[model samples]
Target: MTLGLPDHLVEPILSRALARASHWFALTCLAGALLSALSLGLTYEAGLLWMAVLSVLAMAALLVTLSLRPTVVLTIAYLLVGTGGTYLYTTDLLGLPDVFPASNMFLAALPKLALIMVGGAGSGALTGVLWSTAGFVLAETVTVIAAAEAEVTYLPDGFTISACLFLVAVLLLAGTARRPHRAAQSAIHRAVHADQSRLLRQDLDLRALDLNQDTTLNELIALSRARAGPLTENLSGSIRAALHRLRGTDWLTDADAHRVSHSPGADAWLTSEVYLAIERCRDRGLVVDVIGDRSALGRLDPVVDRELGLAVQQCLINVILHAGIVSAEVDIGGDGGIFSVMVMDAGRGFTESETGADRLGLRQAVRRRIKRLGGSVTVLTRPDAGTSVLLSVPAAAPAAAPDGQGTR
Candidate 1:
């Protein structure tokens, strides 16, 4: 059995799938109209030929927009154009008694197909159904008006009505099925968390074993020296330190305990050079909120860590100097052996082309340093929009020595 999609991904995936299906359906309808017209030798008529050419061009524009930059506004605009084109095409065909009943029905159904596509363009099932309903009302109104002008009997095509109803029903069913979909998503999340917890425990166990081995060796040395005579001050201090380690009393101080308890990955936060940069920014009256998987920073080697820290410092400096905002956010995450850092600020953003060549803060400091370490920097900004700078680097590994040996 296949488990359903995650809760967060369901709507987007559904919308895209529906949009693709609707595009194909509309294309099929358009193709049918063209083929029917051609087979009847009506392609030679000036009025019908002009309508066909314009309709094809309009359809091509709609297809291109849907493929490149699909928006709800553009979808509605295309639907209106399609409805008008369908009415004109149908009116021209109505004057010809030679038109087959199948061709007539197909021509009448074009506007309804366009309206049905509106449903697929929505961000969610409910939204799509509402948009589709509005399009249907508009299309039917236009159809009735066209038939009256032609002085022909107007009968709603059964196929178009059924298609409209089927689309609405599918959307409603999808809306109602959200509860079970969420449950499946929750089950998957729980399973993933359990697996990560198991891996974390194994790693912690290995670290503890190493600490214990070192502590045991120091304790034995102290005890052997003490058997000969009273312990020296250094030996006594060593024994005391080992006892503290064994009891886990000195693992974290009170301040450190609080920090770790409040911050999920305080170990890396407190140890990484990024922490130093944050403190510096804090001193300069910049409020930086650090979040995400901060512990992922621990995977970076010293050289990579230092470079990343400096790059982040430069990003924060730019936010303070140019963004006109006193606050920023730094997020850390990693996936598939790549560590990522994002610095974001909601302030005045500048266009890349507007900046002078002398503005080297970002080009030299942020981008070049990360690039030297085989990393990438991406900057996203526009006038009035916020700025987000992403820095990504490979995870830690031993550096190559001059003699062709790998050294940690």
Candidate 2:
């Protein structure tokens, strides 16, 4: 059946395709049969022998082609029908008294039409059309040659009408084949769009969760712990600042907002995580004198912002708790490709080697974090001298800078 057969054949794509094609073939065959019967008038000059025999075999082939059987079986059925039809028209193998010479043309075209309409469906609509067209052409040519050899005169009009009817069958099967693909494409598009919308909503929920932890809830806890008398100036300031942030677009992350760059550095101060860290340190009662270009901190990706933010926070904490000074300076600046921050304080500093088992925070939290980000951290100090902890990370260009940090 299959020229390229393996031990156990399995062709799902071919099977489904042929199944669809068979429907078209079946309908077209019915149409061809009806047209032929009406045009020629079912004449049984005594008995219905040839028509009965051919119908049984063609119908059997049609059934086999449409079945969920091996592709080889379908191929074999097509071959048998094609050869049988050609042989019947040319020979006396299935000879009967009721045979009409003109009807031989119909016999010639029927086998080919059946193969294309039935077997071709397994391959696909395009293949069905291609093979069906070829079959019809071959049928017409063979019929003309056989008719001439037998001196059988078929009306030119009858031959033309029969060919056109079979052509309609080919078109019908082709349309059926494309139907499934078009429907599947539409369904896939809908599924993708739905999935995107669901993920967008989930992202917004996560951003809200991060904002609650980062600002609003923390301020609420601080306000709840205030003891006695009127509210302190620092607590009042914190409350007001928290309220301002909540009312504005500050809590919204980049994923929930659209960026249209109208001018360079437009919202640099508001978006700077470095400035935010400095402010947080100030709230904790450390006098942080920030210097240098602050805008360089604006466009960092959220992941980088969080990594760099935590590293700088760890540095400042070390300065406030161990440096024996309540004040420090944070210098933020960058060249076109590298952004840097240095927390400096004139306090009792230690040797770099002193950051051992007892001082794991400096070695692991600060140095290791920046190192993982493909950046470096440097410590410049000796005992009784000022300590400067500088951290640097790669910066994306000004134009394509990230708009805002989102939740990690």
Candidate 3:
């Protein structure tokens, strides 16, 4: 069971949620600052005034940190340092009197304000909630001690209401941060089911059509042309092979039939197997423009290189044969442990639904080959839109013996 929101729908929902949380944090910081200023105005005492000034400075620091969009490490560091600085200023290095009029009131709100400013910093909801909980505990404990020594209660001045609101706001922000990941999982489930449905549709519509045109019908035509005599052993074997091909999904696994080769130009540099694959496509009169980091392909293992080459060759062939264009481009790059190559063609494209059973080049040659190499293939195309085939393989080639032999 899953929500079937389209990708465009899901993305905007998550983005707006994040934007809302950011704005919420900023609004909370401004509110806390105003409240702290109000507390200072009510007391008009010198010691308490200095503490309020320090609290305002701390809030400014927090607002600056937020504007910079600090990473998790920096966010945690700022929160700790800001809270520690506030603690130091409140006690005046453990030398100040607790009876300084607004001391408890000023200290109580500062820590919670700092936490509210950064409650949305990390990557997940649970982490933010934990940080908020820790901050609340520390703030409450410090405020209680200061208020008890001053012979006043901390809960009477709207502190309890403010604390509850802060906690609730932090929870809401965390929930917003978490919703997108859950929605993304649901999106993946929907996509897998959609692919399954497309595969079934292709099987139903084109399975018999392919078998009839290329196998059964051809065999019958051959039989009609033959003299009235016993079938030759070779003809009998051919018919049997065609029958076997029609009965099974061999069309999706037969790579040899889809293999392409090219003659390398005398002036060309054979930097990698992908280069070799490009040469093969060029030999077939397809115009291919190469770009990006062409060097990464040279670092692949022999087996990985061959598989990647075959997949690239298949993509180029499709662009030449069916893309309604004579030219294509191959862009290569590496990210972390994955090496990626994108073969793009600005030509008339077709949807996934058009991948009939007879169109086995993409399924068997491009996708299955990359999968065998522990890689993935993604196709983006639609009617009148250009096609881009993103092929990604492991950056670090599999370990082998020193003499270029498999260790196993």
Candidate 4:
């Protein structure tokens, strides 16, 4: 029913289509006036003819400007200039109000048609009706004044009156229909929000399970390696931390807790896609030095964000299991429309050929996920040298604010 376009696009598309149609209609009226004048041999009034020509040109310029910019002020200006032009052109063609009926009233109707177009330029149906009504009143007032100046009896054009009434009826009907459409849209949004919330809860449960299992196993291994004598200071500290983590209800790690204290908006970053991976690594006792613009990660699509985050988690997991070091660096940056994250570890690296097919961490999790999202992964490593895995994806452009400003 939406023609494969998003709901938000329908209104703007309709507005633009109406505006273009109105522009063409106005231009067609102007052309008809010019042709009518020529056919009637009105070239004898050289000054009036030239004035009509200039008015036509000015109206054309205003119409084009209105189409391009489309502000309320510009719309008002277009209506004023277009009304004046129609009056001038009509007087030029008909000469006097007495000759209006003799010319089939086409010349007199030009002003009304120009006025009706104001409705088409409006942002919505109700707004269009208000603008069109104002334009109709102004055009009628001008017509009456011009008729009085000529000392002839003036009568309202029935066609113009009927057209205005028809437009009002149509707009009112559209306004009524819009209420139900908005209600439907709200229902759809609520459904989508509920679904997203459910998915988030499931993801959290999985993270909590992984964290609990990893902490318990690591702590048990430490206890098994202890001697018969009293526990070492490091061993005691590790055991206490493990117990606190197991007993604690809050899922936030040390860094997340510190960020929440200083910045109220830190929740957005803390719960961000890639930060989950960083939090997991920190929980496992790996020192992750995150650098560059962290906000850039938020500009990615949800699927890309999730996949990239999982890839980062796997890379860090590899470091903890195989890399002989306990520290790593994750550099996040964006350049030339590409969002990049580089995970580097100063641990003993291995050759690509030496990696077994069963080791799916790099091949399946990291590289494959990034590749599926139209991104690329680069690995630079050698025997005994540090490993660097760079993941890059197409970065989405930041959305603009409603008031024509850039949003943070």
Best by TM-score: 1
| lDDT tens per residue, model 1, 189-291 | 4465567779977876776787778897768966865657766888889888888887663444575445545454567677898877876665455779988
> C-alpha displacement of 253 in model 1, angstroms?
28
Q: Each candidate's lDDT (Cα)?
A: 0.71, 0.60, 0.63, 0.72
Question: Model 3 — which ten-residue stretch has the worst lDDT?
Answer: 259-268
lDDT of 4 by residue, 62-137 (tens): 8778878788998888788877876676556556424454322656666456666667678777787888788788
In order of appearance, the predictions have TM-scores of 0.49, 0.33, 0.37, 0.43
**Which portions of model 1 show Cα errors greater than 4 Å?**
1-5, 41-49, 98-104, 196-408
Q: What TM-score should be assigned to candidate 1?
A: 0.49
Sort by TM-score, best first.
1, 4, 3, 2
Q: lDDT of candidate 3?
A: 0.63
Q: Output the TM-score of candidate 3.
A: 0.37
Candidate 3 ranges beyond 4 A from true positions: 1-43, 85-111, 148-151, 154-408
